[model samples]
Target: MKLATQAIRHVDLFAGIGGLRRAFDAVGSHCTFSSEWDGFSQQTYEANFRDNRKVDGRDLRDVQAGEIDDHDILLAGFPCQPFSIAGVSKKNSLGRDHGFADLTQGTLFFDVVRILKRWRPAGFLLENVKNLKSHDGGRTFEVIRRTLEEDLGYELHYRVINALHYLPQNRERIVIVGFKEPTSFSWDRLVLPPIGQTKMSSILHPEDGSEDPEGEYTLGPRAEVNSKYTLSDKLWNYLQGYAEKHRAAGNGFGYGLVGPDDTCRTLSARYYKDGSEILVKQDGRRNPRRLTPRECARLMGYDDTFRIPVSDTQAYKQFGNSVAVPVFEEVARIMLPEIERIKKSKPQTLQAVA
Candidate 1:
């Protein structure tokens, strides 16, 4: 189906390095405003999207809804830490509150709600970790659903989508979609390529002199992966012992070692620490290496042309915190037709009787 001919304006909240922006941009949408709180993320975002005029670098809680520009749709991949499995586990071990109780990042969802209520956009798309549905034993999701559906009066639809359909990473995220008025939106409209159809080789750098070496990620005319990515013998031995211990205890906690033909585990923000989640196998007796930042970009469904103007650590976190671009691109494609329908159905603003 043909998408809306008119430009659909969208505001990006918690815009992590503009992943969602790239997705919507693919389907011919314009970003009117954006808000991202991280200083490093703001830097990377500004560097890549220098033309954006209204990118807010401040915390969303401090910014009023009236300060935002009017737009046709709201897009938020809001902070998922409070609702993530790893995040909750970490918090629990630390004896800290999680979910809505966390108060810092946990409460950020309300910011999205306020913007939607104030602007009453034709529709909105929200993304978070797949664990959100089960967080707090499903209480968290219940609150979100009630607020969006009953309180603000929007027709909400959500589903968990895995990135393995589009990229090599086995990442699953919950996508929440809501419309100001009911339309024929359905999950059946989303087209997903067969799972595991895309293998790790698709994203791994060939290193065969075919692709130019990126800065620090690869080297020489042959574009060989830099040695820095290879795990040090000390760390490798430690990880092996740790995995062995866990295995003996009948626990599934261990590093994920993968080859070109195999898909990797979810790349988390902690990847820069040890890269345990996805270690690429090496030839001979060499230790498996962490994916270079470039490979991480590809694993996250980002094209090479997308700028990575940050340190390796920051780039890892940014990519880890981002959504798979192609997954959202398909979502945007399916939503555009319905968004246009909702906009067209709005009653014409009545003129004053002269």
Candidate 2:
């Protein structure tokens, strides 16, 4: 969608493997700056986007807002594990702090606030887990809303969008869109494809001579998936036993197995452990398998052209932590017109003091 006549410059924060960068880039925006802390994710981000300037690898808490470059839009899929449901549950079970109480990741959002207050970009897009809205009995979301709307005075709009509308994964994330000045911006402008239209088959390795084999993810002349992806008998038996135990207690804990035509559960950073959440069903007596890193990429709505320059373990975590590309592509598409309007209405000049 051609929404802008001139290129919009955006900064990517907490940029995990450049998923949000890919979305903004796809819509003709330029990424002037990016910051991601993890070295592995930084490696993958660098490998994928040759045009991106050096990604700041430093902790954002140590970086001042004045050091960042001016940009028209700010994009951040800031660390969400601190506010996610699974993360909260795990932290509670461990008697650890979560949400705003978690000192490390929970405070990163304030850094985002620091930049927003300094740059006052025409628009900004923030993404996080859907559970963020309900965290701390809505008090967490209240603080965020007040910070962005009442304190900063940005026109804010947010919605919890399911990636199933654009991909085969049942991932849901809350996207927050804001503009510096009031303009016509509505969620109705988003063009979402029908849910369940895309299936696992669309992203799965066909293993029918349709594609060439990659280094180790697929093998042989037929380009079948390598046997390494299949779960071992020991692990499979253990997962089954674990699920049965949970079931006996009427707990909801279990593995999710799905075939080609079905939509799968959310892929999580912990998938590297056992791939229990979303297992690929196998034929005959073979055990189910985890999705290859390439499939995980496609499952998150990334095209085959995207590079995976890290180990499979890192790849799983990166993709799991990434935003669904198509969802944000549509978001970017709808936000561009308003961003351009606001840019034209109020030209940005560097503040005398920030």
Candidate 3:
């Protein structure tokens, strides 16, 4: 099948190992600029994208906006620690000024606005936690909308899409797309096949299956677990104790018992800290284990080709902090016609010379 030809050019910010970049790239888009803070991510981005100049080079906060030119779209999976439910809950205790005014809003969002005002790219795609809507009684989102819409003159469309639609994981995120002009883009017709019938078992390699996968999502050794590492009777009781407390307080989080026959909940970078959320069943044993980094990549719709270049820790962090590739690809398919309409309506014009 022939691919979409009216390619969209883009820049990626907070480009963790190019997850947003991969999404846009899959849709036939070209990425011209990328900014990432972590050294491992920088190395992985360069290895995958082969763009040494921007991938490992400049810091987003220090780079001058004028130098970044000729990109039609800007993509950012901006830091969520400032806006996530878990992050916002522990804000005041960090011994720092907090909230939108002191901590979250004005800092990174301002950097994006500075680029928007200076470069004025044709469109932008930004991702954040779904809780960003409710944080500070919705003021944080209001600030972002005001900055992007009224101040920058962009028509914005946003929706919370779950990764289970295209993958075996239950990851959910809010994706906001904006255009420089009053856009006629209609997302109502956008339809993506739900992978509801797909379970974690489908992604795993069968004992005799030909596919040679790196690892299975089974219980592995943990320093704390020691020789008693298996989720034995005592461990099950501990999980029950934790669950009971949260159940009493009406909390839905803390510990989750995911079944191999079903999908998993959201995977976070903290999954590495302690495999609390989506632990897998051990092979030949009954104990629950944390999904390996490779499994996390699979749930996030990344293949072995997309991995094999980053370390386990970096891979987990990048996938955990990424936009689902197929999700963005579907949006791009929906928006392609609109992009063509844009070009037909107003062809490129040469700036007036002094």
Best by TM-score: 2
lDDT agreement with native, every candidate: 0.89, 0.90, 0.71
Best by lDDT: 2
Off by over 4 Å in 1: 52-54, 347-354
lDDT of 3 by residue, 1-354 (tens): 124576557788888878777877777778878888788888777877866465736567787777664677788877777778777667757765544655443377778888878767667888888887777888889988998999888899988888788877787788888887667787786786865766887654343434443433332332122223235567666776888898899987566666668777788877665566776666566667556666677777777676446755667777777777778778766665565566556677312111
What are the RMSD figures for all models against the true structure? 2.7, 1.2, 4.3
Name the regions of candidate 3 deviating beyond 4 angstroms. Answer: 1-3, 52-57, 93-99, 102-106, 213-241, 244-250, 349-354
TM-score per candidate: 0.96, 0.98, 0.86
Clashing residue pairs, backbone N/CA/C < 3 A, model 1: none
TM-score of 2: 0.98
As a whole number from 0 to 100, the lDDT of residue 111 in candidate 2 is: 94
Q: In angstroms, give how far residue 249 of model 2 lies from its true place.
A: 1.4
Off by over 4 Å in 2: 348-353
Residue 136 miss distance in model 1 (angstroms): 1.1
Q: What lDDT does candidate 1 reach at residue 66?
A: 86
